[model samples]
Structure formats: C-alpha cells, structure tokens
Target: MPTNQIEVLGHAISNGKGVQLNLDIAKLHTRTKIQVPIIVERAKKEGPTILITAGIHGNEINGVEIVRQLVSKKYNKPECGMVICIPVVNVFGFLNQKRQFPDGRDLNRVFPGSPRGSLASRFAYHIIKEIVPLVDYCIDFHTGGDGRFNIPQIRINEGDEETLQLAKVFAPEFIVQTGHRDKSFRHTLHKLDKKVLLFEGGKSLHIDDAVSKAGVSGALRVMQHLGIRDFSKELESMDAKIKKPKVVKSSSWIRATYSGMFHPFVKLGSKVSKGDVLGSISDPFGYFERNVKARFPGYVICINESPIVNQGDGVLHISRD
Candidate 1:
C-alpha cells in the first residue's frame, strides 16, 4: 500500500501533506447534521500507519487536548508512513459534555458495531469500517470517568509482545493488564490482530497540564518507535527520557463504606502499604469519622475527587505493587 496517498471521507490526501475532513454521523432534532472531525497526515516516506483516537467518552477532554497538541504544529507531522487522528469520536456526547451518547448509551461499549443498531453503534460501525482497517497500530487516549482522577498510565492486554513493547515505549507510570468487553474497540481491534495501547490519565471533564504534556510526548515516542521519525534524533530533539513503567496484572477499587464528607490524605500516585489510612469520612456535623484504609500494598492510581460520597461508591483505585 502507498503511504503517500490515502483516502478518507471521500477526499484523497497525498504525500507529505495533511487534510481535515468531516465525517457525517447523525442529525440533531433541529435537522442539523453532526459531523465528526478527522485529521490525516501522510509522510513522504513509507513506514507504518498508526491511529490516534480520543473522546470515545465525550466527558474525557484530556485526550482531546492531547490530540490537539500533537497535530497543532506543522513539524510534528510524520516523516514516514501516516498518522490518522480523530480528536473527538463522540461529537454528540462531547457537545453535551456527557459520558454517554444522547441515547444514553456508552459509545465505547458498542464497537465494530452494527449498521442497524443504536446511534452509538452506527457511529462506531462507521469508524471501524473507515479507520480500523487502515492502521497498523492504535493508541487510544482516555481518562477516569465519574469524579475519579487517575495517575498517568497505559493499559494493554497482557501477553502481546508487540503491543506491550509499544506501551513500554510510551512510558507511563504504570502498565496495566486489562481485559476489554466483547464489543469494545480494543477487543475488536485485537480480534483483527492490530497492536493497541490505551493511555489514560487525569480525570474526565478536567485537564491536568502534566498529564497532557506526558500524553503528547509519549505518543511522539511511539511514533518514533514505529519508524515514523528518526528515533534517537527525535528523542534528543524531544528531550524525551524514557522510564520503565511498573507492570501490574491486576488492580482493585476501594469502595466507601460510609456516606459522608470524605477527606483524602493521599493524592494520585501516592504509594501506600496494606491497612494504611487513605482518608477519613465524617458527618457534616463532625460528630464522628470513619477511616478508609488500603486493603493491600500498592500505589494509588485513581481517587475520587468529589468529597461527598455514598455508601458502596468507589472511592479509590489501587494498582498492587
């Protein structure tokens, strides 16, 4: 396949160039057509095709910003192969600033979707048809949803050497072995035998500058690893120092046992020992307080930012050390 010439959304983008195209997905109640933005950059040299996708959950804006920072500059365009970036996949949910589609469906759960399915499924189906087949690897950006803040991390299916190495090259604080649902994009891509790395950080609907910066740099490193650019020169130019992430096979979320005003003692990325007090939950009147403790030795990867919590709500997520 020619790396220089590529077609997307009925438009042909040629070598050493870039193009922004709009893909029509649906119509609003007011009869306005909703078009998803796609940016394609093809290099003059042949190498690998990588897909950078974001905003699968519309409330997660960090990924969107990461994508923006990546494609904003002219020089950042690949020197070989091609880069196809979809900054916001859930246009409807993004506009509404919600996690689910207008039909109340989680878009990420329905992938390689059906044409006759719900709006989310149809939109996903279109993306799988149009984008998935063209890419050699995929990097899906995400963040913790529902008031949870996560340390910058990479999640990949365990035992896939190619994908694992790609995740390592990205160099997040942790590399988690996570299983995806049957209809998820990750699962579908794995079924098609494509290498995938899912990078996650910060929180939904909020931006952490450090996490955003890390995301952009990690993606560039992955591009370098794929031979999209000169490796050592690119790293030196980027001032990128690679770190080996702690690889974990499993993790757990600690749930709140008492409903009240919670005060956290540890922030994201805090290391903790088994049975250490993580936080305190007290009544608004300050009559009594309950301590939330870690169940095992690990590092806190995610914490609930919201002070108010109910019984049985997930308060913290730990990746075992």
Candidate 2:
C-alpha cells in the first residue's frame, strides 16, 4: 500500500514526518457521519508500529484523555517508527454518554467483525481490515462502567512472552494474567499475531487524574522500550511494579438483598477476605439494615458509587484468585 494514498473510505497523509489517516463510517444521516479518528506517525528510520486505542467503551474517558495527550503533546514529534492513536472508536455511545451503542451492541464484544452485518459488526470489520494489520503491537484502554472505579492495572495473556514483557514495560502497579474471551478485541488481536496490552483504571464519566497520568506515562514508557522514543533523560524511573495481581478466573456480582441506601465500607483496590463486611444496605427509614459480606477472598475491583440501591441490584464485584 502507498504511504500517502487517499481512498473514498479514508484519507491518508504522508508528510515526511509520518502518515495520518481518517476512516469514514457508514452514515445514518446526510449531515452526521460517524468516523474512526486515527493518526499514524512513522519516523524516517525503521521501527515498531504501535497502535494505541481508547474509548473502546465510550464511558472510559481516562483512556481517551491519555491517548489525546499522548499524540498531541507527548508523541507528536517522534524519534523513530510509527505511533498510531485511535482516540475514539465508539463515537455514537460517547456522544450520549452511554457505554454501548444505540443499536444495543457492545463494540468491544463484536471484534473481527463482518463487513455485511449489523452497524457495530461493520464498524468492527472495518477496524480489523484497515487498521490491525498495519500494527506490530497495540494498547487498548478501558475503565470501570458507570458508578464504578478500578485501580490502575495491566491485563495480558499469561503465556505470551512478548506480551508479558510489554506488560512489564507498561509499569502498572498490577499485572493481571487474564484469559481471553471469544470475539473480544484483545483476543482478536492476539489471533492476528499482535501483542496488545489492556489497561483498566478509574471510572466511567469521571476523570481520575491519577489514573490518566499513570496511563499516559505507562504508554510513553512502552514506546520508549520499543525504541520509538528516548525519554530516559527527561523522564524519571517510575515506582510502579509488577505485582502478582489478584487473579480471578471469574467474578460474580454481589447483589443487594434489600432495597435501601448503600454505604460501602471498602473502596476499589482493597483486598477482602471471606466473611468480611464489604458494605451495608440500609433502609432510608433507618428501621432495617443488612450487611453485605464477601463470600470469598479477593480484591474489590469494582463497587457501586450510587447511594441508592434496590433489591437484586449489583453492589460490588469481587475478583477471586
């Protein structure tokens, strides 16, 4: 493929510095069209092509912010190779502040999509066809959904050697060796022979400065390690370590036994043992109270921030080892 070729589907630019591309999507209205924003910067010399994707889930604003800051301010002028940043992959959901698209589809779940399928499926297909093949590695960013927060962590396949090394380069406080689900973006990328790192932190619709900063810094560190940039002089060694993350083969939601006000005793990232009182559900009238206890030892990766809760509503998510 030519470096600076522009097609009806997308526009590519090669300005000696690098190549930037903008992909157009199928339109619903004449005036409004959804587009996948992509910017690729390839240096004069040869190097790795790293894909940085954010907003896979529309509500994950921290990742989007991190990628924006990275491309516009940090990696605008690169030392070598290419850095491809896709700031918002799910524009429809983002506009409405919803996690899934109006079509009631989770874009992340429909990876390696089909060309002649549903709207979300077509979008996913275009990404796999036009983007994934051009990259050597990838970093997908995400966060906890509405009313939930997560501690900064990197999730990668346990057996992939290159992925494990890249996860360490990310320097997140926790390295989660997770299993891949069918049709997930990470799983699809792995099938395509790309080493993609997943970073989860903060919460939806909220800005956690610490999470955002850590995300950007970690990305830069990965770029540096890949020989894309030389930041040793200007950047300090991060204190982040690769701890044996609380491994959870599977997690279940803790539902409220009764409807009432919720008062969480523990926050995200806190470890809890079995029988620990995680929180309490109390009636607004203060006549009745129920204690929410952990059924197993694990980390509290996500908790409800909303004060109000109803019977059978999910209150906390525990990931057990």
Candidate 3:
C-alpha cells in the first residue's frame, strides 16, 4: 500500500527510474539456478502498475521478443505508472525448446500454486504471492504451442468490459472472448479483480516479426491509453487497429485419421466454410490420401506444420460457428 516504493525479490527501490530483478528459485542447483527471471520497471510518477509477461508455456518465442523490444525502447518517460516485464517465466522449458517446464508440467495450467508442491507449482505460488498483487493490469503473451501455429489474437474473459476494452485497444487481428479455467494465472488474477489480456500469435520456436512488432505496439498503445505514456506517436504509425475477428463459442481440433505426411490447404487466419478441404493426409507411399475437411464454418486459426503426423494426432483447429 505504499506509493513511493515497492519490494521485489526482497530489494526495495523507491519508484523512480525503473528496476530489474530476478525472482530466485527455491532450490538452485547449478543447472537450474538461472531459471526464474522477472524484470520490473517502476516510473517516477504514480500511475497504474501494468505487467507484461511472456513464456508461461516456454516455447512461445514471439511473446518473449515482444517484451524484449518493449522494454528496450526509450519511450516517453513513464509519467504516471510502472511497467513490469517478465520476459521468461519458464526458463527450463525454453532451454530445451519444449512447451512445459523441465518437470514436464504445463505451468500455465497450474496457477495460484502451492509453495510446497512441485517445482512448477512452487514457481506459480511464488509469482502469485510476490508479483500478482502488485499489478493493476496484466498482459500475458503467448503463441501456439510446439507444432501448432496461430494468427495474432487477444483472448479475454467474457463479460469483463474493462478487459474487453483493453483488448480492443491492443487491436489484434482477433479478439476471443473466452472464459477462465480454474487455476490459470489469468483466472487467479481475475479473482483479484486485475484485468489480464492474453495475446497469442505465430508458432512455437519460431520468431514472427510481424506479430512481435504488433505486440509491442499493442502494449504501448495500452500504456498510452492508460496515461502511463504521454503520446501515441510511436504506436499510431504501427498497425494496431482492431479487425473484426471471427467469434467462436468454442473450437475443435481436426485429428489425423492415419499416420502420414500432411498437406495443408489453408494457412493460419484463413476463413473456411463447412465441407471445405482443410488439408490432406497422405500415406508415405503416396498411394492413399484422405482429405481433411472443415466440420463447420469458421476460421482456421491454428494448424499443424510439422508435416509428419501420427493417427489421432491433432492436425488442425477450427473456430466453429
């Protein structure tokens, strides 16, 4: 409840220029000691504390790059607030280019975690305890998981007008009104009345420059809108306008019926209708091929680009009407 100063990693710094600190892990072996990295920047003025986090799933590199570019820029001095950027929340998974933590846990799924639980859980608990309470608004960045690709989009909890408005300010290609699942960080923050916007773009392990630029611009736009920054000259020129996105109540995955090489007929962001051929799965011999068709009309928001697939593996995702 103090205005002039805040404590991060047990180090108190008066709110002025900005500060960066690493959130230490509970047990640090030489191999894992460097896993937790959280950077906080508090402005000299009193304003809303906004958090920008990425790499909750580890392999989502676009979000990581977005945070990097945002913090590196010399913007209008934060006149009224602070910006906390946690570029890599799951460092172990990132090292191996995996989606989950080293303990094989999906960090995003386990939120408001227990300090005495597993590694991922403890990390989550520490974050909730030390970081979540200090922020007024949050924006978590993400991308499609390994083997999957996504069009740039913002996912917000349905019916939260403030969060919706914030998402619109980001102006992503799509705005998905989704509900929170139990134990998600977004859900936990929502319980505390903090509006957190989740942005998803590109594919895991790959850098999509377009998405990264858009993401950084989006965050700056929000900052400008929130009065953290004075001007939008930097953001105004970037392509951060809201596009009417396809709204799906839910989405379903199209799985491979047999093991084979895949040929996608549509790319990410392509709109499709019922009975359209989304792709084809062909046998190694090329003697047999099965057409993958859209079950309903909607958008092809995600598709698997791995080229090889096993039977029943997720191949494509459609936002159904």
Highest lDDT among the candidates is held by which one? Answer: 1
Quick one: ranking by lDDT, best first? Answer: 1, 3, 2
TM-score per prediction, in order, is 0.95, 0.88, 0.92
By TM-score, the better pick of 1 and 3 is 1
Q: After aligning candidate 3 to the native by TM-score, how far in Å is the CA of 147 from where it should be? A: 1.2
Count of backbone clashes, every candidate in sequence: 0, 0, 1
What C-alpha lDDT values do all the predictions have?
0.86, 0.79, 0.81
RMSD of 2: 3.1
By summed lDDT, the worst window of 10 consecutive residues in model 1 runs over 230-239
Q: Over the stretch 1-321, how does candidate 2's per-residue lDDT look in tens digits?
A: 234432323544453455555676666545567776777776666677788998988878888888888877756456766777888888777888888865779988898999888788888999899878778889999988777677788888778878887787777766777788888999999999999899988889888888987788788778889888886654455444334444444666789988899999997778899999999999888799989999988888778887998899889988767
Residue-level lDDT of model 3, residues 1-321, one tens digit each, is: 357678777878676756668887655345547547666666777889888899898788889898888777755247777777888888877777888876788998888999888888998998998888888999899998877887888898888888887887877777787777989989999998999988988889999888887788778878888988854567556645546555455788888988899999897878888999989999888599999988888888788988899999898988875
After TM-score superposition, what is the CA distance of residue 156 in candidate 3 from its true location, in Å?
1.5
In model 2, the worst 10-residue window by lDDT is: 1-10
Error of 2 at 105 (Å): 1.8
* Model 1 steric clash total: 0
lDDT of 2 at 92: 73
Report the lDDT tens digits of candidate 1 across residue range 82-123.
Answer: 888998988888999999977789988998888999888888
